[model samples]
Target: MFQDYLFFGVDTKVHYSYRMLHLSHLVEEAKQLHNLNTNRALLLSDALLGSVLLSSILDYEERVNLRFHCNGDFTIGTETSFQAETRGYIECNENSEVVKQLDLGNNIIPEFQVRSMRSQRKKPNLFEGLTSTKANSLEKALNEHLAASYQMNTVLKISSWIDSVSGKLNAFGVIYQELPDIPEEVSIKLKKHIDSLPSMKELFLLDNDADVLSKKLIPDITKAVKSINPKFVCSCSQERVENVIVTLPLSELSDILNKAEDLEMKCHYCNKNYIVSMQTITQIYASRNQVNSTNSNEMN
Candidate 1:
């Protein structure tokens, strides 16, 4: 099986930077975890690739989130940590006429509201940007976000292909950012180089090492500065599920406890189910009241 990796490199002269990604295995894992149909898989794959591309700008321990609101009924979200751990999901109103009529295979939507959020591990502040595009292209929207938010010159390309025989998805992308103070001629040459290359699908099909591919894209990439393996990692856990249950209103907790059946919670990102037994719910309910009473007594 082919592993997924992201390679970071810079021009020999330090005039530009590059990030190359090979995410087919990671995307396949997501497709299986979410049990997505072809169209849903394609959209999620694109979102995943786009999110990783944006991660190039994140500092260590920081995270970036990408959300796509399609029309009014469909939405997709992807999150990637600076370490390249990624998770994403697709959501839609299954009964909505608009969602039912959407031909996602064509990769065309009437409109998309793209929002990006960046934050550090323990930071209280978040940096967010929102952009709207009618092009029905996630690539274009992401490029717009980078330009407007970071004021950097970047070109991003994401491509995905489905294997006809194995029904597997192969997806990858490249991010090229021209460093500040780059001469106009150098910038023009870089653009021409990117344009003249083969399609992303073709490049990915070669199955070349990420470093080798980076060198192909930017011949001046003397050495790789960073290499990361991105994988599908979900943050959901039983304790988190219990915390969610504890936050419910007394009535809701009572209703669930009265049922005498385990409450099942499913993670949106990985579709993993966590079962909260009635006994556990009752314990949490009691603990919630105990904590509240302790606070009340302290105030008194």
Candidate 2:
């Protein structure tokens, strides 16, 4: 189950700085993730997953992360920004070797199931991690992370789901923060409302939109307070890749030249390739000292 996608869209540089996105309507079909085709249903789920994360970071301007780890397959994990509109990936291998990088969209998932296993399996990057199994859902897993790690004194949850017949997707998530010396009645009422809300998927599936969901759960006192528009953005580029290669030690460059007549590198996130032929390599090495001398002269 999912409801309308909602977030506070803030662009302080603009005239109308912000507005609330219903995420009320999504394209009938799913968007492509790399070369893979994502189902509309799955896209909605992914969007909701991104939305909840965006809200947490955007509205309060806090540094937070939602990650996935388990004994199950598809250990794709992502962490969002505390500063910019970005996210990063944590990639893993069969032997459970994990590596972190800015390439996140490449982390593929096979199936949607966050189920509990018996006998308590133990291993690295496990036991303390969280994830959602139902229809690839992710909100509850995030809530648990906030509660367990930050020991946050707040109410937050992301409820998302879609209908089986219509195939449309919707999502809504709420986060509440407290100020020191906050009112006792406010805290008590907020807690009750949070407890009374329906399952996140249910909230998204049946509700009108994010606003409706919020009103239904916290009928009286809750305020629009803030909203944000979550976007699917990545940080990868051709120039950055070039800078990396150019800065590598000459020995590493020599190795590549010795092994192959041409040197080629592909960006992991963008899949764009850069190729340097043996001729270029030879010329570059020959002129290396001269080029450095000229650059030094220019600097002085």
Candidate 3:
């Protein structure tokens, strides 16, 4: 059983906080949900891991938002709530020429968007940038986005891979940030050391130990912040789908009813199917008419 969570340690002496993520299980779940092939799955797994790492720095009650508009076959998006629940989907044209580019390891220059939603009532603070994706290396692109768009001093390393025999997917990642008080010399040293460290693929396959990895990367840590396990969870439900179906144009609803066919709605996030019976549509139509009549009578 693969455990998934984000772990953080803060060194007041160095004025820096270190974070690590072990998310093999979560990545597997997400790939299965999206039905992605190896390359596509690797790309999306990297994005999801980055989203989770980014969300960790959010203030209380804030959520992480990420979007990608690429000149490729598909547009991908992911969101993580303040509570660590994540959902995402990919939209694509079946016969898009960009699909060939994606398969051939060509650069698909993607416009990346990142943001933090403070609350439901307030507008989200947003950041955007563009990067040329080189196969499976999203960390480099995301790091550039952070530096160019947000001007934050942070370093991230990611690794996502699939088993050749079983086709099982896994991911591991790390992020280190320099607080305002940290001296430039210390930051530089840490960054150089982290950059020189072995890739996540090598480290994960050699020894999947978080504590050992932390000590090897950053030898100083005065405190450990809270740790959390994030999961891929969709927010769709049968009731929500039903409410949406009832709001369709009356003519459309009547046509479905006349055909005596049950309407099926598949959620993009989880691919769960919801069926709406004609009887339910009829009841909803009647209820809508009654409310409209009542409002008109009150106006008179």
Best by TM-score: 1
Return the candidate ranking by lDDT, descending: 1, 3, 2
lDDT of 1 by residue, 1-300 (tens): 568888888878888888888899999889888888877787789899999988875655388988999776799989998889999999988976656655445544777888999886787778899888776777777777777777669888888779777889889899889888998888998999988888788886685666557767874545678888998888889999998998898779888888889999998888889999888988988987788889999999
Model 3: colliding residue pairs:
none
Residue 54 CA error for candidate 1 (Å)?
Answer: 1.7
Clashing pairs in 1: none
Q: Rate the local accuracy (lDDT) of all candidates.
A: 0.83, 0.44, 0.73
Question: What is the Cα-based TM-score of model 1?
Answer: 0.84
Worst 10 residues of 2 by lDDT: 10-19
Ranking by TM-score: 1, 3, 2
TM-score of each: 0.84, 0.55, 0.76
What is the C-alpha RMSD, rounded to one decimal, of candidate 1? 3.1
Index of the highest-lDDT prediction: 1
Candidate 3 ranges beyond 4 A from true positions? 12-14, 104-137, 148-152, 164-166, 242-263, 276-300
lDDT of 1: 0.83
